[model samples]
Target chain A: MIARVVVVPRPQVADPQGITVARALAQLGFAEVRSVRVGKYLELELDGPPQDADRRIEEMCRKLLANPVIEDYHFSLEEATTQR
Target chain B: MIARVVVVPRPQVADPQGITVARALAQLGFAEVRSVRVGKYLELELDGPPQDADRRIEEMCRKLLANPVIEDYHFSLEEATTQR
Candidate 1:
């Protein structure tokens, strides 16, 4: 199964990187640019059948895949429904 | 509008960070773990109405948001149809 995880930082946390990028964009003449927050995206190929992929992946995220205090993460698992 | 961008490294690119994490997980007893690829995730709160959100974000991804040479990205926009 292919697990695609997207981790987003909480709104209140200080996003220095995002702010830096925003400033750079403005300097580059992208006047319309407003805000930017950066996070992590992970793609994992798990060895598992489809029947338990979602539950297993969710557990993995809650455990080691995400930092709950500062980030929120969600994942989609694919290529298991038809596997026999 | 909320723009969430997930940037993933091309499969051919070396993912040292992911490999390190995977090895750490194994040492920590996550024996089920196999392979890992790390990427980037970004969330942007745009100062615009929803009408043009999709088109605008896609353009952003193709331009300054993602590095097409080594990464792939996708995003979704929200809270526009109900805006009055």
Candidate 2:
């Protein structure tokens, strides 16, 4: 299975990286940009049955992939295929 | 408008961070893990009409959001709503 995870900072949390990106965009002439939030996107290839993938991925997010105190994570699993 | 951008390293590129995460997951007892790839996700809030948003976002990605030599990026735009 292939698990795609997205981890984002909680809305109330301040994101300096996002702020910097927004400022940089403005400087680059993208004045339409008002705000930006940066996050992590991970793709994990797992060799396992789909039945337990959700639980396992959830645990992985909580223990390693995401900082529970400040971030929230969600993932979707799809059957792995031979081609990219 | 709101744009969600996903920037990922090209497949041929080496991702040390992803390898480290996979190793850590294994240490944490997630043995089913086969491989991992890490990427960046950015959410941008824009104050403009949706018509020209795609062109502007493409330019932003080419100029600032992604490294053309090493990364590939794609984005989706949606109408911004008042509520979260």
Candidate 3:
């Protein structure tokens, strides 16, 4: 299966990276950019049924894919046909 | 308006970051993890109609959000309800 994961910092967390980019954009004259928050997009292939991938992905995120202390993660699984 | 942008490295580009994570996941015994590709997700707000946001977003990607030589970007815009 092909799994796509998105991990974003919680709203309450201080996003220094985002702030830095915002400042840069402001300096560059992109006034239309009101605000920005950065996150991670990950695509991976796993060997499992859709249900199994979902259950295991949750554990993977909690244990390794994301830092639950400050970030939240979600994923979707699709059948993969391309050879690895 | 709220815009969501996803930027990914070209498939031909070497993604050291993704490879590094894949190796770590393997070491951690998640053998089901076949491969990984890492990218960036950005959420930002702009003051404009959805169509305006789309046009400006394309310019932003060309000028800042992504490097055409190695990355590609796509975005979606939606009406934002909450105050900035």
- The candidate scoring highest on TM-score is 2
- Top-DockQ candidate index: 2
Per-residue CA lDDT of candidate 2, range A22-58, in tens? 9999998889999999999999999878899999999
- Which residue pairs of candidate 1 clash? none
Docking outcome class, model 3: high
- TM-score of the first chain alone, every candidate: 0.85, 0.95, 0.88
Give DockQ for candidates 1 onward, in order.
0.61, 0.93, 0.80
- State the interface C-alpha RMSD of candidate 1: 2.1
By TM-score, the candidates rank as 2, 3, 1
Indicate which candidate wins on lDDT: 2
lDDT of 3 by residue, A1-84 (tens): 988898988999988888887777778777878889999988887875667888778877888889999998888888897755
For all candidates in order, the CA lDDT equals 0.75, 0.94, 0.85
For every model shown, what is its TM-score relative to the native structure? Answer: 0.79, 0.96, 0.92
Q: lDDT per residue, candidate 1, A1-77, as tens digits?
A: 77788887788888898998778667765555578888888877667456877877777777787889998888887
| Candidate 3 runs further than 4 Å off | A81-84
Which residue pairs show backbone clashes in model 3? none
How far in Å is the alpha carbon of A74 misplaced in model 3?
1.5
Rank order (by lDDT, best first): 2, 3, 1
